[model samples]
Target: MNRRLYRGLREAILEGAIAADTRLPASRDLAAELGIARNTVVHVYSQLLAEGYTRSRQGNGTFVNASLPDSFLSSGRRARLAAAPQPRPALSPRGAAIVDGASASPYQWGAFMPGVPDLTEFPHRKFGRIVSALWRNPPPDLLTYAHGGGLPALREALAQHLALTRSIDCDPEQIIITEGSHQAIDLASRILGDPGEVAWVEDPGYWGARTVLQANGLRIRHLPVDEEGMQVPQEAGGEPPRFIFVTPSHQYPLGPVMSLARRRQLLAVARRHGSWIIEDDYDSEFRFSGRPIASLLGLEPDAPVIYMGTFSKTLYPGLRVGYLVLPRPLVAAFQAAHAELYREGHQMTHAALAAFIADGHYAAHIRRMRMLYGRRRAMLVNLIERRLGADWLHRDASLAGLHLVLTLPPDMDDLRVVEEARARGVLTRPLSRYYADPALRRPGLLLGFACVPEQDIARKFEVLLDSLAEVARKPARAARA
Candidate 1:
C-alpha cells in the first residue's frame, strides 16, 4: 500500500502531472476512498515530506512543494520497490470464512428492512442531556481503562431491570458489559469453547451468532426449529457441544416460543452433556401481546446458561451497550476475560445509562415503543392479509421482535424477490441466506415493520407486492419437462 501510494505521488510531482502548490486530499478522506487506515496515508505523507516532495501548512493540509529537484526521480531503493509487481493480498481461511458468512446489511434504514429499531423515536434530547451533564465535569476514571467488568451502578440497574421484566434473577457481579451482543458472543465463544468443538445453533437462525462462533473455530451444528422451538437431541450422542446458542423466547426468522417441555428438555440435555447454553434474549422487550416469556436461565436453578442481552434493539444500535449475565461460577472467568479482551470501560455512558434506568426513563421509553411497534406490526399484517392473503404470513412466527417472516410459495425465489424489491425501493432480507444448511433454506422474506413509519407502510407494501407479483401469479409446481 505504501509503495503504491508513495510511488504514484512522487512520480506525479516529478513529472509535473500535478501542478505546483496543488493541495492533496486530507489524510482521512484519502484513507476512506482507498479503504485503508488514515494513519497509513499519514505515514506516506510523512515520507513525502521528508523527501521534499510535499510541504504542509499548520491547518491547510499537505500540498505539493512549490519547487522539487529533478534528481529525486532516480531515488534508488524506492524506485525498485515501487516498480516490482505486487501480488494480490491474501487472507487466512478463517478470515475468508468470516467474510463469506457475514450477513449484515449496509442499508439498515428503510421500510421492511429487518433488525433495525426506529431510532427517530428514541428520547435523544433527554438521553443527551444526561450524557452532556456527565461530560461537564467528567471524572478521570471515566477516561481510563477499566479493570472492572462494568460500572457497578449500571450492572446493578440492569440486574434489577431483568429480574422485573424477564424473570432472570442474577447478581450484578454476574454481568459483563460489552460493546454489543456480537462482542459478548465472541467473548463467550472464546472463554467457553475450544477450537473444533461443536456449537449447536438454530437452523434458519441468527447468522451473526453463527459467524462469530465459526470465527472462533467452533464447528457449527444446525438444529431445526418447529412449533415447539429448537429440537435438541434426547442425549449427547457422542461428544457434547461446547456451546448451544439459542433464542428461546422468540426464535429469529421463524417465530415460535420454545415450549415449556422443550425448555425443560434443553436444560436437562445441556446439564447431562456439560454444555453451556448461551441464551441470546435479544429484543425480548416490545412483546406485542401477553406477558413476555421467562428467560431460559430462570427455568432451573444453577442452569449452565449465559444470558446475553443488548440495548441495540431496545435503545439504539449506536449506543454500543450489551451485557451478559453469567452463572455464579462463570462470573470471575467472564469478567476477567472480558476485561482482558475488550477492556470494557465507558464510565460516562455507563453512568448515564444507569441513571436513565434508575430514574425510569428507560422503562418509560419501552412502554411507548412497545405500543408504537404493536400498531405498526398490526398494520403491516392487516395490509398483507387483506391484499395478499393470510397464507403468506408465518402464523407461528412469534408476534414479538422488530420483524416477521413472510412465507412465499415453495417455487418462489426469495433472494430474487429481495433483490428486485430493493431495486424498487422496498428493502428486505432473503430468508434463504439465514440457513447454514443449503437444503433447509426456505422461500420467504423477513419484513421489518419497526423502522418504517405507519403512513408509509402501505406505500412500501405496494412496492414490495409489485416485486412479488411476477412469482405470485405463476404455478407452484411447474415442471421443465
Candidate 2:
C-alpha cells in the first residue's frame, strides 16, 4: 500500500472533505485520476478497509466510514479552518433571522446573568416531604390519559393562586398547564396566529420566545421596552400583529415592571387592533425591589391577554410546571391543541408540587429565598460599586431580577471580553449576542449572581476585571483579528 495515498484519503474523509457515507471512486478510476497504478489504489483501499476508515461492499465500491481515527480527523484540518474566513449568517427571507453566533463563555466571574434562580437553597427537604406524601396517596386520575387540559387539581390551585396573587379572574376550566412558559408561547403561536403573520416580541427579549415564534413561522416585530415596559407602537408598519408577547411583571433581561398606564395603553392597543397578548409573568414571585405589580391580564379580565406563568423560575427549572390563563374565546383552541398533542402534565411531579404549594411550605420557602437572594443581590451591587466605582460605568441597573446589566466602555468587544473572562473560569453573556442587528449590539455584560455565593463574587469579578483589562490592552484589530 502507498502510505501517502492511504493517509491522504483517510485525512480527506476524516476532515469532512469527503463526507460520511459518501462513496469513494472505484480504485481503477481514482488511480487514473491520481495518475497512479491500479495496484497502488487497490493496496490503499485494502489498508483503509483493514483500519476501518472505509467500508467496501462486494459489488458496490467503497464508502467513507462514519467513524475514523482521531489522528486522521485532527491532521492540519482545524488549522486550515482557523485560517479560512466566513461571512455572517445570511438573513432568512421570512424575518429576523437567528444568526449562527457563539454564545458567551459558560465560565463567568460574578456572572450577572438573568432568569437563573438560586439552586443552593431550594428547600429540598420540603420538596422530598411533598413527594413522599404524593407517593402515599397518588391521585387516581394520574393513571389515566390527560384530556389535553392538565391535572384538574393543579389547574384549580393555579387559578386560585392567580386570583389571590395577581388578581386574575379565571376559572380552572379556562386554564391549561403547559410544559413551561416556552411551550405556552409555542401553543399561543399556533392557536393565536397564522403562519407568516406578524407577532410582536420585546426588543432586548427573552431568546426562548423569539426562538419559538421564529420556529412557528411568525414574523416578529421587535417592540422597544423602557422603564415603563414595552411601549406598544400604535402603527406597526401597516397591518396589525396577530399577537404580542410581553413580560409585564418584570421585563426579562431588563427587569422593569410595566407601569399601570402603559399596561392600560397596551391593552387598549390590543383591543383596538383585535390582537392577543401573551403575558409571560416568568418570575413575579421573586420580586425583591417593589410591590408586586398586578398582572395586565388581571387588569383587563375579559381582555385578549394569554397570561402565562411558570414554576421553573419560582420553584425549579426541572419541575417543568407552568399554566396559561387564556381569554374565554381562545380556551377551546388551546384545549384542542393540547388534545392533539396528547399532552399531559407529569402527574407525579405536579402532584408533589401541588402538595408543596398547598401546604404553607411553598410560601415559607419563598420567604427564605427572598431574604437570602435579597442579601446576595445587595452584596453583589455593593461589590460592583466598591470595586468598579459608580462613575466609571453607568449604574442604570434594575433592582428586581436575579441579575443586572452593566454597560461596558464603548471600545470594548463584549464577545471577546466574555470569552477571555471565561478562559480564566468566569462565565457571562454579552448583551450584543441578544441583538439581531449588529448596530443594536450594546457593549455590556449580564451578570447572573443567584447561583454563586457572596464570598465568591469579589474573586470572580477580580478575574473578570483581569480578562477585561487584557482585552482592553490588546489592539482593537488584533485580539479578535
Candidate 3:
C-alpha cells in the first residue's frame, strides 16, 4: 500500500503533473480520500520529503520542490534536454578513423559467423573444477596486478606445450601473457615500431591488426596475398617497411599456408631491410587436413619474429588468454613493456588454465574439437560445393581454420549478399571488409563451420542460398523492369 502511494506521487512529480510549490494534502486527508490507512500515506509522504521531491514546513503541509535533483531528472526533463543543441564529443584523428572504419559485428555467435568456435562442445566441467578449486583458497599474488609479464605457472606450462606441439622451444621467461591476440598486436605495434614508419600488412588481413597499427600511427602498406602467401619482392624500391605482419601457418580469409621458399625469402628480405616479422598463429590448432606444420618463429635459432597465439579458438574466448613468444634479445624489454602498458592481471584464471593444460584437459579438448570441427567443415563444404559448384570455393578452404571463403563473380557485391543473408536470420561476414584498399576488395563470404552444428548448418545454408538467389536475381529483374 505504501509502495503504491509512493510510486504514484513520484510519477506525478516527474511527469510535471504536480507543479512546483503545490501543497500535498495532509496524511489524514489524503488517506481518507483514497480509502487507505493514514500510516501508509504518512510513510509515502515521508519518503517523498526525504527524496527531495517534496519539502516540509514546521507548521504547514508538504510542498513540491522548486528544483528537482540532477539524479532525479525524469523522462520529461530528458525530453527537454534532448531538444537543446548539444556539442559533438571530441576525438583525435586516429580515434575518429578507428571508429569510422570499425568492422566488428554486433552478432558474435551463430551459423556462418566467422572466427568463432563451438562453445557447446567445450570441456566446461573440467575447466570449472580447476577454477572452483582455485577460488576456495586463492593466493594474494593472484588478486594483485600481475608483474614480470604473467603467471609463472601458466608461462611454464605454455613453454613446455609450445615446444612439444609447435616446435617453439623457448624459456618460460620469454613468453608474455596477454588478454587476447588484439592486445598482443597492440603491444608489439607500439613497442617494436614507431609512428610514420611503414608497416607491410597483408591485403585482406585481420582488421584488428590494422586498427591497432593505425591507432599507433604506423603507415600501412598493403601487400597482396597469393596462393603462396604474402609475396616478398626481390627489392624494396622505395622506403622499406619497419614491420612485416603475416599469418604464416594459415593465411586469414584466403587460408593459404606460406610456402617454405616464400618464408625463407621473406626472412632474408626482412633481415636485409632490418625489418621485424609479426607472425599471427591464429586458429592454427584445428587444421582439418594433413600433419600440422611447425611455426615460422621456430625455423631459425634466433628468428627476428614476434610470435602471437591465442586460446580464443582452442579454448573459449571468454577466458581472454593469449601469449607472445619473443626472441631472447627481446625477452626483457617486452616483459617490461607489457607490464607498463596493459597492467596485466587475472592470475586466478591463469592458474586454472595452467592446471588445465598440465592435466592434459586442454590437449584432449582440442583433439575432440578438431575431429568435431573437421566433420562440420566437411559437411559445410559439401553443401556449398553441391549447390554453388566447386569453382565458387576458395582454393585453400579445406586446409585449416573455422571459416571458408566463398568467392563471388566480379559484378556481384559481397556486402549486399551479407545484408541479404543477415535479413534471413543468418550471420556472415563479407571478405571484402578485410582488405584495407577499396579497389583491392574481393567479393566473397567468410562462412564459419565450427560454430554451427551439422544439422543446423544445412538449415542455415539453405536460408543463405535464398539470399544469394535473391541477390543474383536483383540485376536481371531490374534490367527487364
Which is the leading candidate under TM-score?
3
Q: Which stretches of candidate 1 lie over 4 Å from their true place?
A: 1-85, 471-481
Candidate 3, residues 310-330, lDDT tens digits: the string is 999998788789999998888
Clashing pairs in 1: 255-397, 255-398
lDDT, model 3, position 107: 92
Candidate with better lDDT, 1 vs 2? 1
Q: In model 2, what is the error at residue 54, expressed in angstroms? A: 30
**Which parts of model 3 are misplaced by more than 4 Å?**
1-50, 54-83, 476-481
In order of TM-score, best first, we have: 3, 1, 2
In model 2, the runs with Cα more than 4 Å from the true position are: 1-113, 136-140, 391-396
Please give the range of 10 consecutive residues that has the lowest summed lDDT in model 2.
101-110
Note each model's CA RMSD in angstroms: 9.0, 10.9, 3.6
The TM-score, computed over Cα atoms with residue i paired to residue i, of candidate 3 is 0.88
TM-scores, one per candidate: 0.84, 0.76, 0.88
lDDT of 1: 0.89
lDDT of model number 3? 0.89
